[model samples]
Target: MAAPVPLHPARRAVGEALAPGELNLVGCSGGADSLALAAAASWHHRKESGPHAGTRVGAVVVDHHLHPRSVEISGQAVRQLKGLGLEPVRIVSADVDCDSRQGPEAAARTGRYAAFRKAMSELGAARVLTAHTKDDQAEQVLLGLARGSGTRSLAGIPAARGPYRRPLLELARADTEAICAHHGLTWWEDPANSDPRYLRSRLRTDVMPHLREHLSPTIADSLARTAAIAAEDAAYLESQAKEIFPTLLEDPDASGALRLQLKGLRAQPPAIRRRIVALAAVAAGAPAPSSERLQAVERLASGSRSRGPVQLEGELEVYRGARGTAEYGKLILIPPSSG
Candidate 1:
């Protein structure tokens, strides 16, 4: 009997994340990382036996139309995905709002993910896989640190969120490029990635290289490791907060305001407490509070000297209940338009 051919590491990685008989859509960008992911996913689903039997792989190429040649690039990606035997290969044009307050990179990302979600719904795919390698993870960590973000931001990009999954987080950018080369694939290089206007692009071109040279040769690996540890810590804290969150709710008022038991909230550690507050605010139709806003909420909940009906984003406000009322020692999240 012939010896079984060894699976390529990229293919193995893709297969490990995917389950049998499930339809998955690869979000290909015609870039090295995404193209390699698409290639590996196709290879995994092509298997007629073993773990991946009956699995189907499709592809979605989102064209943000940010660059002049975006449509052409998307067409090339679709052709490549089709060549790899990916069924239902589709190209989606995203209307990216460059003037968004979130900035260009974030705006483009928002548009891209929206397109991915729509494609998944239309294609009946169980999950949308994107190529976010270890290098990207490291970049995210650096960006978070630069912005002085909290543990959740430092945790970097999640491996899986909702219907989206990133299978290449364990692989390096070089690994993806190598895989693409091995497959004789020519990937498109997005100019935005190297443009100095974007902070991420600047980091990729200048800061990261400087860090790699001056700080540590394996700085990306170290950063990725840090992200993994942070992710574990954040996930545990979030789970704990979620478990305790419902117990703290003290029944909503008639005007659609949400109230939490201050005593119960104050008992938790700072990490869990902040998360719980944020969760409650979101549940009450408020945008996710910023670090500064969270601190303000914390102060209000702590019964600080300043009595506050603390104004939060999305027309929501947080107020501490008066000492004599039935709502005493409660943190009330007043919804929009509630007096």
Candidate 2:
């Protein structure tokens, strides 16, 4: 067998995140990024000591079946994983629902995460690592900017979400490809990455190239830095909102909806105020509210007039009703009408 190429930086990140002997699962797509991650994880396992000694590394390739040869691609990934001596290799099929309002990419992403959660549970894995890199972060920032998204959207991809972690968020895509080449590993390139139909593909293959050539030489790195700063700001704001939430939310009604008292909420900064309203909506069983809906609820928090009651998607309604004071009423999340 050939020697596995070393990935010093990635190894360090994975090592710091997980204890020795713990199971580390990689979400591999046969692409260069994930393939390199798998190789790096294997090397990290080989060097483990203490309780982490003999750490088990595995790969879960989620097959969305959106293409004609997805299964073939998955099989090739399995072969490559086995060649790297990774155990517990599994391929999960995801049911992607495209009929909804969300874009195709989002639907697939949702399905893929569900599969990863299931894999974690069945494998008893302590962590799941993905291949999202700094380049992906730049693209995300661009999308968020184009859509006029808030700080949370501009924060781009997080390094860690629950049990899932992206250890390569600081690394570039070229680095992953180079790592694969150094290991003498072959990686499968997905056709979806190049298809112009997807906005992300256009951003990756064309828009970024144009910007790199004509715009600032370090545009990608700069955007990635923006994301890091935005992430920091978002974390602080979220912590503040959580602290203030208990005071703002009145007792739940018969319908289990939490009412937001304007007396305390109206004085907070807009960022924290919006987060409070959005969190209240989600807590009341509304799926994450859109930016427009969030703003609508925020206006209600201020006791705005002229505009009628705010009707959010999923039949969740938000309105201001007299509770404590006439001048400043409370904003409430009403459950979807059964009728």
Residues 112-171, candidate 2: write the lDDT tens digits. 999998898898998899989889999999999988879999999998888888888877
For candidate 1, write residues 269-303 as lDDT tens digits: 99999999999999999899888899999998987
Q: Which ten residues in a row have the lowest lDDT in candidate 1?
A: 2-11
Off by over 4 Å in 2: 1-6, 46-51, 306-308, 322-328, 337-339
The TM-score, computed over Cα atoms with residue i paired to residue i, of candidate 1 is 0.95
Against the unseen true structure, what C-alpha lDDT does each candidate score? 0.89, 0.84
Instruction: Give the TM-score of each candidate.
Output: 0.95, 0.92
Model 2 is weakest, by summed lDDT over 10 consecutive residues, at: 321-330
Say which candidate scores most in lDDT.
Answer: 1
